[model samples]
Target: MTTPRTEHLVLPGVLTAEQAAETVAGIRAVQREDGAIPWFRGHHLDPWDHTEAAMALDAAGEHQAAAQAYAWLARHQNEDGSWYAAYHDGDFRRPTDLSRESNFCAYVAVGVWHHYLATGDDAFLDRMWPVVFAAIEFALRLQQPGGQIGWKREADGTPVADALLTGSSSVHHALRCALAIAAEREEPQPDWELAAGALAHAIHRHPERFLDKDRYSMDWYYPVLGGAITGAAATARIERRWEEFVVPGLGVRCVLPNPWVTGGESCELALTLWAMGESDRALEILQSIAHLRAPGGMYWTGYVFEAVGDSRRAVWPEEQTTWTAGSLLLAVAALGGDEATTAVFGGDRLPQGLPPECCTR
Candidate 1:
């Protein structure tokens, strides 16, 4: 039976009342005592994925747990308002990857704003405002003249000038969320508004500014998913490469010319479709990936559909990740009309920063 809290998480062919609870529990179980949500118990945690899982908890009515996750970010944030790309799960103080990614750092705003919307906690928003502000600033400092953000900074703090389509798209979404937070607090950040406009313009009209990662499914849909491309453009973009990245019942392929389908990409694509007002297609996509669901309500990272020599088609990598489950729950939440999830992904209620004069001119 679905409780009132998880009732909105129930989706036909996606999650049942009990199953939704289990999935929520599955993510929560992966969250350590200090609020760090690693991929799994022994795996590493990245800021973006950790934030995604935290947002899933919010969608499941686990507000306190979600807040804790945000608190963890606040506690561990680097002096420059960024986080290392990957942290060892067993010891939060130990960073396995020292690079700081723009998208990864910027994502705190999305999760913070989502948590605020889900809980209506003014104090939480107030407390997280600085964290979001600093993180966005760190990312925007690397924004190129073309408006696409540089992908990351090396361990030695050298900025990588190259931008990635998927990463910039994600950063674009985060900037809007950060702007929304500013709007809520009556703190108008004109610079952020202009930066957002430039970023969106780059993502929508200046793809050349970004590296060609088109072979990855994320590059195909992230611009749309990230709200930088929408309306007819979003629909056409999805349709243009639908067959190339989507593999029907198995889920979305991680990359082209590969027999691999990943649960994270499939769920994100479903979320993208839902955001495009194609709920029926979104539901179908979600339902199609049911085969990736593992026991205990977690989902395997991906499956390799094609057999290689003596190896049969199997769940490749053989790891069920918290972020994979989180992505699924978020997609189901959007399809099920969870207001917080809808507001975040729906892109209508969120503020659109002023259009850049460069793009307009």
Candidate 2:
């Protein structure tokens, strides 16, 4: 239950084995009775963050708990194969009226596949097949004319914005995971493969069709980390935006002209660096962000937009976030050469929820 024990869940050089284990224990403390993982006990839970927390649980060898987390998602899924973007923390909680985010809906496949890979339990995958199938079906309803996935859908199923590059890139990874699960079960998924390959191609060749949000670092590097881009192309993209967003040793800014450095985006950038084979630099990035950690295993959402003369005092207070810890685990997992993350969420393979272009080279 201590930090040191949690550190052993990952390989050396990522966290002081002690630090990694401590973070894992922090996540363990947040699981609800229903197996849903809130950011913190009594805090609201969202599907995307919940899935990341479950993956952290699996990484910590809490297999049964991780499985229960997915079961919660399955039981709560809406009729159209999606879940609401948010949930209230209290009892008798209904959907919070937020639209079902396509990317969040798609993420379950990757989480399910990761659990299966970690545990090698075919029965678990079998149990999850229907849920995974339904989620992918719901996500696909938002795919626009160009193979880009629309960003979100209302409760009644109306589409929202044009496909977001970041969300679709994440979906591209999810689609590949779903296909892998299908392959493991010897299930036929020709359409799934076709959809994945096409989505990857769309991400590769057509970046303009997506909403322009280069303001966020996730939009800049996630495609590369998620395997939607590679070689000199990926490096070039990082280079083009590095000066605009990165703030040296602290972390990455959520947007330009903002002095804030967020642990989540910093860790994600580190993972993307590892995906590009720059593991050493990725390690440095992870190490630099360690300073952001607070008393518990939590991290501030970001540094303040304004800093004092010493740059030590934050002008505005920040929220301590679970996803910040999740992002660090994902980064550490990538740096330590964790095959599961690379295989499930990395490499050139498209994940489960993407459209046809995902698998195309």
Candidate 3:
């Protein structure tokens, strides 16, 4: 039985449950109609963020609303099985970009899988399978010979080598869901397992095959966060980069030597720490950042990145962000022993196509 002790949500030296809940409340207050949640009220909604927000809501037990969020995505999916990057709130009509992002499309699987686990609604899963199926097909187009996927598709269908380590890590997740959907339907999808394994291997063994943009925090931690890299290597990567980026009691910085720590990245770090079974440390990271929460359940995107006694400066606009809160809820669910986190953190290994690197002791 889980106790209601403050530490249940707090990370030892980090946040208390009351503080975490306050930030969560900030997130909940920003949900828009059409089931889209934005970074702030009056802000534009993006597909990746919307799916992430939906996952948080589902984990928080707001299943019905979360399902409606998925329904919104289904209704809006392009014939090619993609969604534009952004949409205006008041209109919710005009698309900001018609280009198809493979990484963006891949997130559908995560959202759908989370919703399914939360509710056990097979009917919902059946309705969503086609959407997931189409999206996976879209992701396959970006799969490269080295197994890391191309980043995005222009309207003209030109594929570029923007293959991000973080993006490919996400596709690894999408492939798992595609295979799960296939299994549920009793259909054969031997190819997905193969593709997933190959991609994971390229990421695990041959990091140079992809672009070397390690400056971004996502690149540093996502292999672990998205479950692509694991065990000692993952721990090593985090340890090696710890002082380079993490700001101690402040949260995670968006870039090296940048005097700012963003809530979204901080929450994501907490998630990664939780993934590594260091739940206490993960909770500590989350707790440290809870002070950023604003009224109405949202957070200012970042804080000043300065040493003790240095004057703080240039914080990003104070906004109640959907993804920021969503990431936190996902982390909380993970710490709370949610099964979805277990499956994700366990690396979703399939008996069929797990690469040699993944199976290594």
Model 1, 95-163: lDDT tens digits are 999999999999999999899999999999999999999999999999999888999999999999999
Lowest-sum lDDT 10-residue window in model 2: 350-359
Q: What lDDT score goes with residue 263 in model 1?
A: 94
- Per-residue alpha-carbon lDDT of candidate 2 for residues 37-92, written as tens digits (9 for 90 to 100): 87665567788888987886776677888898999998888888988888875122
Whole-model lDDT values for every prediction: 0.92, 0.77, 0.75
Give the number of the best model, judged by TM-score.
Answer: 1
lDDT ranking, high to low: 1, 2, 3
* 260: Cα error in model 2, Å: 1.1
**Count of clashes in candidate 3:** 7
TM-score of each prediction: 0.98, 0.90, 0.89
TM-score of 1: 0.98
lDDT over C-alpha atoms for residue 312 of model 1: 91
lDDT of predicted model 1: 0.92
Q: Count the backbone clashes (under 3 Å) in each candidate.
A: 0, 37, 7
In candidate 1, clashing pairs total: 0
